[model samples]
Target: MKDFLELLQRGARKRISLAELRQHYFSLYPDVQNSPDRSARLLETLRQLETIGALSLPAVGSWEKIGVPPLPQWVLLKREPKAVPRKDFGNVAWAPELGFWPELRPGQLETLLPINEFLLRRRGSLMVVPIKERSLEIYGDEKRLDGMCTGDSLFGGRLHLNTLGCFRVPQPLPYRMADAPGKPVLVVENHNSFWSFGEWNQQARCYSAIVYGSGDAFRLTGRALQQVLGQVAGSGAEYLGDLDPKGVRIPGEFNRSAEVGSPQVSPALVFYQWLLAHGVRRHRAECVSFDAASLERWLGAELAAQVAKVWQSEHWIPQESLGFEQLSAGVL
Candidate 1:
């Protein structure tokens, strides 16, 4: 039941049908799937919830058209009827989007008092506080709230840490610079490509630097490119990766999310062209969903059309298809 409400709260759609619920939730939780008379029990649970105005069926096969807000309220009453939060909690709130809460402990109310005290102080201002700094100030331990922000665990059942108005500081990307004084830097998604590019740059001196994106690591750390480019005096950056949905998404998202004045990240067009013409293809069943607008935006019309055909065929080209020796031979 808790899982059911949680899924409705976070699912992309505002309302989920019975088929989607069965397909998604049943496959994910074994206990729910294995219950005796599970279908009957699930319908019974929905009927009971409907009677209480906790949720509504709408049609014969739908569940919870209006999500989240009303859900945690019913769940709170059902699970912890004996333990309840006081009405005087002021401007502080448990993030309404979350459809769950932590188990209330003995001194949980007392613990929540100070946590709310910290949150209330930050209520009106745009204070861009560091996550650890905010965590230490609110909770006693500096590392107490690490990895507890999303869907994991709510602290003390009364406070939502995500609403604390704090931001995470991303770490810098790992990179190697060419000894030469050129301004254009190449960003490589895989380590092998970075090594090949780095070795080639050492001799060819074609680029000012080569950045190792470590697959998806560059998404967060790549935000720091304004500072990274400042170090090398870089004009702009070109991104090259495996010709797949995820690889395309990495750079597209990275460039879109970049701060003003950050070095531009474009597809390593020349390298991608080579990969398109000669790169080896690996077939993957799940690589067919690259329908994001970023697909056309990042790769342009012509290249995106080619990549779309590859993705539709359920295949992708690896960056490694362009080897070390060829790169060292000034093959861009």
Candidate 2:
């Protein structure tokens, strides 16, 4: 019965039909197929829940709607809840319907009555507080229903809380470019390769900045890279990755993302030819055919044909093989 209520709460839809419930139940517990009269037992359980006011069955409908009441306050309060000295607990509110509080002080609330009232009023929602415009604060407590309050540490001297500064719930790729360094940003596929370029740049100082592609040129990384490239136009961008199917696909994706007709290649055709001739090969059996169409679409026919030839020969050269010496020498 508790599982049933939990399932309904987790569902996006407010109501569920009997047929859907049976299907979901069987899917969740496949072993139930061996039980005799499984449907009858499930119906009996529903009837029991209806009797206890946990759910309701309409005379004219085939669905059982959730009717569980909000959890009681006593269930939420710690045996002896206590308020922190000189700290404000007024803003935090409890949400009993969700079975937890939001934005609560870590060690506050000595009594249960105040906390209970807070829970009853909010039901199960966090209380919104007035924050400075364009500013965002992170506050959530699954225990008490206090309104909202910002912590001193979060707002202390080092960091300013704002939309731009705040670490949003889901972070995008780590897209960073050095401050107005130079032209032709170097975009490397793997983190190791990006750092390798960083080390090489310290001495060679060829590129304005080095961007990490975070593998496969994820859409977020591509978009962020495109924006960074836009800010520094004439500089353009060069892509470098392993000489394989995925590596070829990444630069192609980047060209589309940056909306460039013909993007520059990294390591130069001469260097690529050298690597194809001398570079070590591993995972030959696992090497799959390259997507010739995507390669052609992004890298142009000349480079695409070169990569396809390498793929056909079952030869792959990782970017690391280029070595710091070759990289620093501006081999590309």
Candidate 3:
């Protein structure tokens, strides 16, 4: 009977049927199925609750909670409620008309229950704001306000934030190189390679810029590659990474983009061939099979076949294995 009252109080629907109540009772006591008088006992409990003005029968089949208010002590207590905690909102205090508590920290609901209930009743909305702004708006405690915001942004040139205000900056992806030096861009995978390539570029004067592929080349550098290639008029791009499944796969994925026009991106075949010649060991255990068909579409038949052979052998060569000295010696 107590369980039935608790269910009615927590339920979103104001009314329930006798059949539903019977199901609820049976669910609570599955063993009661074997007893013949189980239905009679369940009906008696419902009648007892109705007699105590805890529930009411509006129609022949349906029942609803009466206008009985919760004990004042229940509201006054700061401890957890006796009934099961709500799933959506954790522990909560019950009131007559108001539903479950809003998402809040432990003692927060206890201290601010009246204010929260008032806001809900009068405004018909929860007072939602950032944690730092809550005190300033609710209690008029201006001293508690602290200016802080969170998220990521990208810039084409530069930006400066001096005041407490929201700012939206356009991403620098699909980045155009304005008045860039006349040379093809070299995309380097590792940080060491990126720096080494930069130094080599200064001496050899080959690339416009040495872009960093940052490990996951496709996901991290795809948009930037497209932007750089699209913007630079006569300049092409080449990718240099480890001669592994992932490294081989990166260049293939980049060429898959329809937006980036032809003379499509290709792997640095010369550098890879150098690594193989220098006795770069096969990491057969780590190597996984490659899709020859996909590679063939992006890379020519010869390069794709070579990559497939390496993949099948489970052989890999990290770009770092071909030290800066070796890489600098082999010019693109």
lDDT of 2 by residue, 272-327 (tens): 56566656665664456567787676556886677677677777788777767777
Where does candidate 1 stray beyond 4 Å? 1-87, 91-130, 144-166, 259-264
**Candidate 3 ranges beyond 4 A from true positions:** 1-180, 220-222, 226-234, 258-264, 286-288, 330-332
- Output the number of the TM-score-best candidate: 1
Residues 248-309, model 3: lDDT tens digits? 66766656632334445656666666766674766775666666677676556877677676
lDDT of 1 by residue, 142-196 (tens): 6545534432224523344446666556677767887766477888999988898
Sort order, lDDT high to low:
1, 3, 2
Model 2, position 281: C-alpha lDDT score: 68
Which is superior by lDDT, 1 or 2? 1
RMSD of model 3, in Å?
18.0
What's the distance in Å from true for residue 280, model 2? Answer: 2.3
Clashes of each: 0, 21, 1
